[model samples]
Target: MSSAWGNQVERWRAGINAWVTSETDTTATIRVEAVWQSVAWGYNVSNGVSAFCDCDGSDTPYVGTGGVYASKGETRTISMYTRDFTVPKTGNDRDVRCGAGVRLAGGYHDGTSRAYCSVRISHRTWYQPRRPASFAAKRSSDTSQSLTWAGDYTGLDGGYPWSGVYVDRGRDGATPSNLATLGWAATNYSDNSTEAGHRYDYRLYSYGPGGTSQATDTLTLYTTPIACALLEAYKPTATTVGLRATGAPAYVDSWEFQASTDGGATWADAAFDEDWVCADPPKGTVRFRVRALKSSGGSSPVTLHGAWAESNDVATLCAPLAPNVSAPGVVATGTAVTVTWQDNHPDGTAQSAAQVEVTAANGTVTTADVKGAATSWTRAASQQASAGTIRFRVRTKGDHADWGEWSSYAVVRVAVAPRAAITSPAASQVLDALPLAVAWEVTDATGVSQQSLSIADASGAVVWSATPGKGVRSLSVGTEAGFTNKSSYTLTYSMRAGSGLTLTKTVAFSTDWAQPVTPTVTPTVGDGYTLEILIEAAQTEPAAVSFDVVRVNPDGSKTTLVSGLKGGQTAYDSLPPLNVAYSYEIHAYAASGAVLNYVMPYLLDSDGHEVLSFGSAAQEHLALRYDAQGSESGKASGETFHFALGTGQDPLPAFYADGDIDVTGSHSYVIADADEYRAARRKLRAHADGWFRDAWGNVAVVAYSYQISYDAKQYMQWQLQLDVTETMWEEPNRG
Candidate 1:
């Protein structure tokens, strides 16, 4: 049995308890006990012994001493007599206790061995139970009352359910106590019940294995409402009485009307009405205010006041009367009078029914209703039968009460007849020619009715007269034929009054007349080819004078050449022997007027030219004073001529013997021949000294002439010389 035990022991570790027993030595029973420490695991033991041995049936090994031996000890090594064993555990419990009070029974025999063993063992458990962590709560917003909680038991592998968060209302006390059983979701709490003027309190809680925590410091909160709107005012009338407030919501219940007369200082309550009647008031100037009463009992004052206005009760008066006499008086001749007044009113309709009154002199009173549309009045002519001073007064009717006082009196006078007098050509003696104008002045007690005036010449012939209508009278007059020359004349005037009266006046005047004298001329010769004469006549009757040209030679031969001459002046021409001496004469006839006669003669050379000729000549039977100067003489010889440039005598020679000698200068000389001198004189009949030019330049000749020579040769030579010297030298200095 021990041998068989040894073979089974080879399959396990040596330190393990192994046992074997033999019932017949061919079959065996083996037993072993293994032990390990509390912290070790995975034990195994094995023995190197084969259960199939070669001996069979007849072979028997020797048994050990003492029937069966066993050995057990701690081993550092495993041997063939011991076996190793295994247990399925890991980590710190891998070691196993073996053979400490352990018991085993097993056997292996070759027909004779047995073995038994005992072991004791113990092991420690390697796990502990987990505990929960501290409780914590997470709060989102205090005002929102939202919170969450987390701990060690949360999301555990194998533990109890997690705790929930809790919140308290604090001073607000609005938290729901039932909320502890339910988790604190954000929507779970509602504390928003406090008013806008106040504040509230709040707290947060977390529940774990322990009870709920205390509430946090009180957190307070508050709320408020929304905003309001505006209002306006208006005025509709000119009187400023009907003022209104508007611009309000439709639900407004009532309105309050207030007024301010003195620029909004003290306001008076006008009215409070739901119908808005206070908006439309009476007349006058005023300011207004209003308040709106809303249906919700809310009231707002007027934000604006309407503009000011006026009323329609005041009236205006008429303007003062302009200063003038409208109606002087109502009276006949030598009678008493009455008067009226006038003015302009501003209001045309209000003055339509106005009235006026008047008072006269002698304390007498008279009243006349204003007739038609006229504003002035006057007494009737029958009422003013006697002439004198009169007074007046005025007033208006209807709503106007004032009456105008009495006015100052006006004075006037009357007479029986108008006064008459002459108004033109005054009352005195004075000379007047034909066509004399006559006039008169006529004024009367009534007025001038018929005014008349007349004029007559010295022969008592009525020349002109006039009877004018109402004012002055005038007419023109003329002298009568056969009246004496230079005699006095008379004019008379008359006037009749309008109220049946008469007056007459007369005045005298004188006039004169003198006739004009007739004139005659003489013939003369000059340096030109022919001899001619010009005669000018002065006559009161110029139509009556007659003129003729008669040629009288130096031999006393006479011939009547030109006749039937008319006009105030006449000229005659005749042929004379050229460059030879000749004498000529001119005769004039007045027929019915006074006559004047002048005779002149001249000397001509062989060229049929006069030797001497006067510039201008007038014959006088009497001697006259002479004033002379500057190279002037009365004689001429050969080529040298004596004459004056400016009243001075000197001899000047001719440039040529003869051929139309041109003379021009300022000089005065006389011709000895009466007829020739007079003919030369007539050339300047009306004009005084002036400029004369003849194809040369200009010469000045004085107006008067005297005659001295009659022989044609001597006169011709003298004229030629005079023309060359005086007329030539005195010519204008034309450089």
Candidate 2:
């Protein structure tokens, strides 16, 4: 039992014997007998059956019901019927081989794993006798004809001797009636019964043991004189032509000879005799043809009648019409231009094509082709000779001869839109005058129907606006109250033409009003009770001031004697008059950093008085820029001062450093309003924000650190630097 064969499956082939019982075009019914010889013990039952190409149209599956048993040495048969089988029949389509198959229809559980045997009905088939090839009839004379053919006659049905060869005759156009029967061995026949002007058709067939073959190839013939036509056509001149042919002109009772101009589009006819000639032809290439007419009331000419002969084609030429042309008044770049024309040459000729002549403003003349005889043409603006004043002219040429005269130039200017530029007040300019004058220029425009310039203030109010007249090339605007010091303004300029042309531009500019200048300081050190320092105001009134008079003891620690005082000539009478190496600093600030800060004053009194010469600790500097836009005074347990900036700054790509190329920046200035703050912001915005932008603008966070103290002396003092870190950059009024 351990041997491999013990577990192996012995599959058996279920035997099927099938044959077709009845068949329709699409379906067939088959009778089947399924018998199983028990190759394995007790494996002999099949219930139902199905088969292919038999009666049933589908393939057979296992049958589980009907039982067939063939006990050792005895045979049992199970008969089953299947219907709806596809017969696949058409013409000679035959189920001649082992075509029908059967199988158990369903749910059969016999030990047999395969079909044991399959039997298909078989039979021998035979073919018909071979028919002769090329069996044809030809005229032997004006009144007689002969028929001939060739093929193997003794090779059909395993060499079945022929019984006889049958021949038939009929008027060429009528049904053939049976004629005499010839000896089985003959393949040719002669007849003296054909007419001179008649046609004839012939066919040959053969038969043997097998059914007759589909009729043999057929042959057709004509015994008429005109069927042997020989026609020819010739042109003697551009307007004259002649035709000639030979056959039995005597039998060609009537003939048709046609002439074509324009490659057969139309035809002109004449009697097809020897003297045929066509007079004065119209416009086109000439081609000719002739056909032999059939005898009036008799029969068809022939099976394959004579056709038109080989001939030459002639083109009738004439003068072409000079094109009458016109063009549009306006043209644009990359747009199509339409030019129309009419061709009218008295000699009857077509307009071959229109020649376009173009002239540019620079006097460059160029030409183009508008091909075809159409009444109109379209050319893209891109295909125009030039983008300038492109003038056009037209002419035409035909197959006949000459190119017609070019028409007068139809002028059209290539349209281009106006280009705008700010000739004055360059971008981001800081003007000092209250009424900023903005000037702009427009070139390449035909005219300006409406041109206006407007400037908007911090609150977005249009403080100034004006419209320029037509034909205006440039405009300058200086409006009252149009500009505000320490504030930024947006200027927009736009223009419109009657031809629907448009151009627009916008730019930013601001003005600086309070420019701090250095005050004239005259310091006279005096021994009196008050230090007389004569301080004259700078170009503008100095905003605030502070000074320091220090005494350095032997160590580096210094002592303050007279400090934190207001600007003017501060006569500090509270001086300790420290005689120990004393030094001092005088400082001042402009109201805001939008403009320059005034210089510090020197101490002076009575007349040129000095104390140990003079030692200065530091120079004058301006206060940092700060704005009170969203700032308010509030009360907490005591009091609180809260301020905000921007709505907060929008993110920027990068921050700009002090002197970058196209990025212009002014480092020395006071910052007050949004205008001044924005100017300074632009200087560093490109560089600072990129590091990490917080709610407060990086520029504001760094610039507004120079805080002011109200103490008299410190009020005038300016803190030049404030240490900053990433965390300190928060919204200005963040709780």
Candidate 3:
């Protein structure tokens, strides 16, 4: 049957039966059920199975099946060879079969009829769970931890399975000494491990569907505490102290202060206890130290030794000391007191205090403190004993030491007593007028402190007094009748005790006083036609006088010519005045130098004109004859001219001429012959009228045509004839 089936499968394979399905006890089978039968040959089963499934004979499997079959479904049990399923297996066909079975059953099948199939499958993915990130820590007394995390799960199968994170501290991979766990979905966490040091480690992990991933690289952390120390200290002396401290690692919130006077064995709270420190501590001295304390309980202290000193302790000793005194010296009136001393420090040190002692001649002694090195002591008046000698001296001292030796002695002399006396205007004399002069003298037993003189008139009134320092004194008695007409006055003189002595005296005196008088003068005419006068008397005593002149005119006019004359008399001259008659009045003087009376007026002129008179005189004949000779004949012979004249006067001649004739002869006769002649006359009868006169009023000797020629040379021969006579002449009227 196998041979026959094989022949038929081969025929079927060559014919149409190529697809088939079958089941068996240990394998499922598939075959081509239809065959191509020919009429020449009966139907033949051929092409035995094109595709087949094989179970490893676990349960149902088909040994053989042929021809066509209807819808046969198969269930089978197969044993998979683990060796055949191994990756990278040897033997290609066997490996292909194993891989194809797994793929076909697992629902990854391609539409192909094949006896074997094979495939390769793998996965590349990341397993990162939510873990902590940005870990940080803060400084705390207690141990603590803080952290944050990020989450990412991609390219992972079955999504991200349950995941978590944990923190542990350890150097090695041993069990974690300290561990902290965080569940999945947790991105941040904080843990207080109460740990602090320079070295600490932490670990982070990731978990997914596959397994837990390797832990991340370990991280280390460190922490430190705050520090503080001293920064500065100031100590001027054992008692004065100051301190300052600095906070290290951080800032300080406050400060503490304490002080100790007995070394460090005991301490007391300082007056300046405060938190905030200033640059300058309070003034004055005290032991002090300070500690800077931070908010973190950190502190630093600065203790200063020998910090303060007393305020009044002298830094340098160079000031001067007070002065001292030596033995006292004797004192007397007008005696110099000598004081001698030395400075405590001989190098001319300035003294703060000094003093001296004085012993008087009267056995009295006293002490006087000197403000500075130099001092003075004066003698008392009582020390001048019985007009003898007195002496004194001085002493001195200074800051560093006392001075030796007293100053040289000084002495003064006492004088005899004095007595008061009056000197002038004689006492108890006659009556007088005002302004009387009084004088006096004063004396005492000892030196006088003061002296004076007082004058009282008859009316019992004190007129004046000579006080001290004014050596001479005088008084103006009042003009009242009782005082001015006083019969006598009393003068008192006194002296005061200057060196312990005094004296007083009184005396009588009188006055012959008189007042000044007015002055007068006599009028006179002086040189230069001036109307002047001389002062004859003064109207006041001692003849202090002046004079003035006034010209008096006939028409009641007056003018001042001179004034301000001295010497009790004056001479004035050349007084200017209008034309008038004037007179003089003479003044008389009394014994008191006053003007007593004036003389009666003496008239100088009555009509105010100066007059003159001529005496006896007679007239005479004067003749002139014209003698022509040679070519000229006589024109007239012995011409006679007559005129009335007076003594010392000559008669002027008158002559007639028919034609021009030289009058040189005529002028000569008039000049030589006329004595009282007022003037000469010349008459001429000519065809042309002409006349002329000469310097002496004589007619010119030449007469030209229609004019007279009186040339000086032609008149040089003029003479006049005088007649002796006398006549009364009156003064000419002033025009």
Candidate 4:
């Protein structure tokens, strides 16, 4: 069996078949089968069968350990021991080709022999698709998560065709399971089954026909909670604003809000209160936005803002302006009062109701309401009590807001009362005439409805009564019997007000109807134009009486000649003006200084004269002149007419025959004193050539003469004689 100089040389052929069974990224496994065919059997020793491969395109020893030996023509086939060989990089083909052959070394050797059979068996290696990298996830919706990764890497799948990708999902750190399979073209996936406000884990694998690859790193993400949308913003009160929103997922624990006053140009954080209310906002238009929050202080992103809502005018929610009372400050007891207020609602809201509260000094309280835009309320007269201070306040309500604050209190004083009093004819007064002047005064603030006057005797018997007109403060009422002389009487005045209040007053008075008796008065001129006045025969009625004499001067001024003089003791002397006529007033008074009677007398001065003339001779005679009368009471005497001069002169009987002396003149006078008598005599001498007219037939006065006579008790008297002639025949007309 040995050849080669000292070795055995045997002819043998080995058939071998080799194929790959498994492979990895670094190594490959192969299986081989061979049979030994001995050409000649000689010196058969232990020659074994082995395999060889061109792992790197070169003939090299096959990596194997065991070998087999067989007899010539035995026809034995032994399986090669399992062996692994390192594989090289397979580029885009994902395949490594190797040249392989089997040999029976140590027992047979033939370099050029065609062995029994040499076969080429193909070996295939395992291939895997690329695994994705850079995995990421984000919220796609309120209930879903979105996933993404880089494209599949080349040179790693061993030239395998990509089929699809596998997406796995898990919740709260749990192990992930296959959630979906997507084609290789899909770079993103949506986890639609995710719940709102939940944490999820996600991974992805790029797979081909080879198999699925390793998963991406587990990703943890949270689905967005339902978004909070702002519904409205409005003022709930004057100082507070409210924000209303809708939408909240099960995981949402709270809400956040922001407000803007400049139409969303800027925003301020608003306090998150229950019902989304904010306090003490600016008084004007405002805008609001809201978002949901989690218990961990995580909230929706600021970029995801809700709709802005505009608030109502802040004034609209304010209480109505303070009310005002328009009632009078001072009122009568039963006067009605009306209260009013202004509807100063900033939004001009319609008035819906009003309330009024009233407190009286007597501790009485009253409240009332008016509905339907009524701003005023009236308290009836029946509700007003007399003699107290009344305080009242009011409040108003609008249709859109709550009732306003109460107004400041208004005070009213009710103190007026009906009053009646006798003004004239005072207490213990004495009246002197019938229809005694009885005057009274009455007053009532509410207004007088009725008034009356009455007079009664001392026994309270009503004797006279009269109804007085409205606004009549005084009335005169008394009959002759009611006002009896020296009688005591009572006067009563009664008044009633519109509110049924009445009052009466009584006064006591007496009547003194009897007056002092009238007195006789005589006045005479004394020496030097002095006046003398005497009063007598007076006052038989009144037990006590006095007389007063007043000299009325020409200038209308009075000089008291005598005041408070007894009836028989009234004699007065006064110097009189020479030519001015004056008068005197005499009054009779009772004991109480009341004027019982008065008289005014006109007195003549010395210059006062009468004219008597005969023919063309006219003379201004003294006041002693009068018509001739046969019966003289010693006041005046007669005057005769002569055709010639006085006794010292010669009578002209031949010139003035009996028929020539047809008329005679006679005149008389009483001189108050010697000065008067002298004055009269001087006047007669001044007109000594006077001719006078007589009451008899035609008489002519050629000369006149006067004589004075003095009386012991009466004034002096004077007589004058004149001769006068009648031009007309008055005797025939008289007959």
Candidate 5:
């Protein structure tokens, strides 16, 4: 078990960390982790999780309950106590500790998960029993008296029953006797040493290993001269019940009557006579008793001796009231309806059968017998009232022989079947959230009791539902969050009229949210240098979305190149150059400012060719941004830039084609800079800036355009002289 289940065993070890006080002293609460192995679980089977304690450790278990197993991965902490662990016949104080004990946690294979550990009771804790009850001594014979009693409780012993009862007794005028011990099961004992005229009392106690409990009721027992009593009561008149008693010691004369109206706690002397008349007998059940009283008329110390006989029980027999039929308050005909009513009796305590009498619109009365006191009854579809007025009344038969009177008639009206329509979310309606409202024209003399509106998915699963209140023609659903967009739903509104007929109308719709088309940013012009950022989509349904255009500059700052265009507008020359490789971003946002989609517009560059563009670092444009501080008049823009090749081949002294073919300057055009003019010039290949005309002999200007700003912002200052070609050298007066 250790090698195969090392991780699980370690987890169990960590969970069953140490013994805890169950927050209580006597019982030990062992904490065990809820993890278990499921290898023994059969195919498509799961195991129940529980913890058991084998106090005897003999493969026998005790009772326990564990937490619910939601799934395999989740677990809960289980605290097993001595009660959850102990087996029968195990001594709690001694057997709570483990030598032959084990804790079994069953969330594994066939519930065989187990951990062996010792549980020691720190010290002998005491469990005291409650005070004993019903300690009484009754006369058994002329020479003996018997005692009977009950002790307080058990269940703390863990595995064994509480045993041994302590009894103490004393004579009426003497000191108490020594304590007498009786076995746990012995509830009665006979003291055979009692004399006929003496009185004695007994006190009871329960003793355990801890200590004896406090005294229970100490009742006095005696043998009176009159050993037997018989009391007879009879109703003499409508309101009078007289009681008579016969007792032993027959020679006593002049009997005085004593009566106890309250079941013989205290007696009233002659306040009630054998034939006293009462205006009203008590309504419910009452108890009465009669005590035999005797008095001597002689003057030699008159005495009265009397004793009470066991009481008699009686009740006034009255029939139950009518049963109220409470449901289908607005019944709809032509359908089966279950009639329900509140229990006329408390908690369904009706003692007799009930009957429901139904009078149909045709004046035909039918009485239905209800077997027991079920308050509600169902009328089959065949029994539903077809037209006119039908009424119902109910009666109940109680514990007595006779049945009660019928209840007052509950008038029910029957009318035509209900008609309804789903007015809102009309047919084929497309909406983000499915809001439903239903209208009904159910013209019943009696109004509708319940009406509901629900939206069901295409699979007929109810997605939303609601019950409308009274006088409401329309009911709506769909105020909850998180709606499924790309699906169809059926909105059904149903109204049940007064005659139990339900009318329904359904409307089917689709909530398919067509995603916005991906707009393109393209280079529109046929130049190799510039790109046009355009945004558009192929929309089937017209949507309102504001366009946002952003240009990412070289240093990772964003410029709002263009924005707030609903559609169909263009900004010319707003884009930067192609060689700078800027990234243009376009987004379509709804009125809520929630972005619908990012627009990666097609890049249509100057060459009339679609090009893939990139940001500044890699310079993969086919697009660019010319937004940095510099002379902005296309100052650095040119057809081709030139730099000298190989020191210009000794400066081409005579300019012969064959003499310095290698000295011809190399030409390329890619000087896109973000710096000022002078700093920008330092970045170019080493060369002189004065330009000669091309071989075509057109005098091209290489003049500089200047830019100045207060701090860093630069604007163009354009100036050029197209006639100049090169520096003139002074020819020693030969010009």
Candidate 6:
């Protein structure tokens, strides 16, 4: 859309200026200004003009749809609209041209048919500041550094305003880490976080609204280290020396010292102790120097040794005599090691003072001074945490300024920690009875002096304690001890050595006194012709018991009819043989398979028929056959013998004889019929050497015989003989 011309075909001149104002990935904005005069080609005037751009090096106008226009013969500028066009994103620099031409109403007019013009486009660039030059760094103090650089806004891009300068700092040629943006006028900065004697690298960058300039060359610098002032060394004795210094700079952590025995020709590291005796300096003149340092680095040594060289020769006071030293051979971590020594002054002079040096396992040496009258010194246990051999040596001074030579070192071992463990009554074990048996063992280098064992209930009260003594590692407690059933306990055993080192161990256990009780059994006949025995009140101490009902068979054998019955079980039915008497016994047990109770010999007759009989209690009765005769008798017998003696006066030398007595019994019965006779015969043969109780409640075994006179006889005579051993109703084979 452009302005229209009045009745004339507007002709454009080639005097146009075009430049790229802004650019993007695919297109650029070009502003155009032109000076033109309208010339009429014919009386047919064009209505308006349109602007266009050619980007492909071809002079042809690519877009000519709309543009701004100027009125005829008037110096006036009007807005113009251009038709849309596309540019290929081929390169960063593009040759773009913008201009206007006549537009016809029917179609686009060729450039040759009318006058058209365009100008080569130029891109615009903004201004940026230049890099700062002459960069430098300097140390201000031990902990701070100052940076200075000469900089200006010269060589700025199109005179654009700059923001500030950026200083980047790093260490040991590393990439820049710290960045500081300062005002344009600021040419220096003070870094307060610098470490003493540490190296730092710095560079400068200048930036503006346009962009940042290239970085300057890096400058490396190191912070200053503190220097020690007034270093001095003195000899306290012929065998020892001392060094002292003061005046350390701020931020200095500690000082390091070096020694030179040959006039500073060669130096060796020396510990920075106030008194150099522990360093073991040589007897001759010694030179010393000192320096100050932080954790980062150390400063140069301050060599002021001219005032510290010792003038007295080391051999003037006579070389030291060996002292007699004695110390413990072994010790525990928290036990002290006592060392004693005798002053061996050759001249018999009274001793004034003494010094003892102790060397730890890690090669650290320490010293202590004592009066001459003191013969022994104790090394504190707190300083013996490390476990290894430690060494001790002593030197004495007898009214002299020089200390004698140290004695041979006495070696003592700091033993590994003593350990003791409970080996019996394992953890979480359950005990059935009292008087717990406790056992333990210990491994230690130092022999035990005293040992104590104590048992405590779950409430932490000591219920029982063993007799306190040494050399016994185990003890037993019985029911007489103060212990409660159905309770948990902890056993603690402690062993102490003569050196006052103690070791302790503990184990936990519980006591369970719950046991089975003899159940009251009630027997009755059931539907299957069996005995139904009910456990009327089979109770247990803690309610976890099992019951077993076993039948003792006639032929010295046992049969378990029922077993593993818990507390909730009540009754068990047992099938038995017919026509023979039987007895039953009940046993109760705990969950741990321990038999708790056993009650025996509950007798009953089978189905109201019997071939034998046993004694009964006051209200109890046994079934008996009709018209039986029985007899009982006793026999006593003995043997006597004599042997001649060699002595004439002795008539009878020896007589070996003993009297014996046994009770015998017999019974006779008549079997009514053949069937009864066969049954009785079978019963007698089955129980012929088996155990049973006689009518008088004595345990006996019987042999029987029966005689039938003829096959048609209706009755048979049965005869039985019993050999009774004891009056007690018990089976010898019963377990």
C-alpha local distance difference test of each model: 0.37, 0.48, 0.38, 0.58, 0.48, 0.57
Candidate 2's C-alpha runs over 4 A off are 1-146, 149-163, 167-186, 189-203, 206-305, 309-318, 321-735
lDDT of 2: 0.48
**Quick one: how many clashes does candidate 2 have?**
47
**Candidate 2 per-residue C-alpha lDDT over 246-281 given as tens digits, one digit per residue, 9 for 90 to 100:** 563334444566667757666776443355666655
lDDT of 5 by residue, 184-243 (tens): 677777777765434566778877765677777666555433422765655554344555
Q: Which stretches of candidate 6 lie over 4 Å from their true place?
A: 1-165, 168-201, 206-209, 213-220, 228-256, 260-279, 284-288, 292-735
Worst 10 residues of 5 by lDDT: 628-637
lDDT of 4 by residue, 637-687 (tens): 334455656688866443322333233344454455667567656666666
TM-score of each: 0.22, 0.25, 0.21, 0.30, 0.30, 0.26
Shift in Å, residue 439, candidate 3: 6.5
Model 6 worst lDDT run, 10 consecutive residues:
614-623
Report per-prediction Cα RMSD to one decimal.
Answer: 41.2, 28.8, 44.6, 48.9, 40.6, 30.7
Model 2 poorest 10 in a row by lDDT: 1-10
lDDT of 5: 0.48
lDDT of 3 by residue, 232-330 (tens): 445433223334445432333444555544444455655442532333333322345544343211111222121121111111113233233332322
581 in model 4: Cα distance from truth in Å?
Answer: 99
Per-residue lDDT tens digits for candidate 6, residues 509-626, read 9877655556666777643234567764355454436677777765656767667665545544333444445567666655544344455554544433323422121111122243
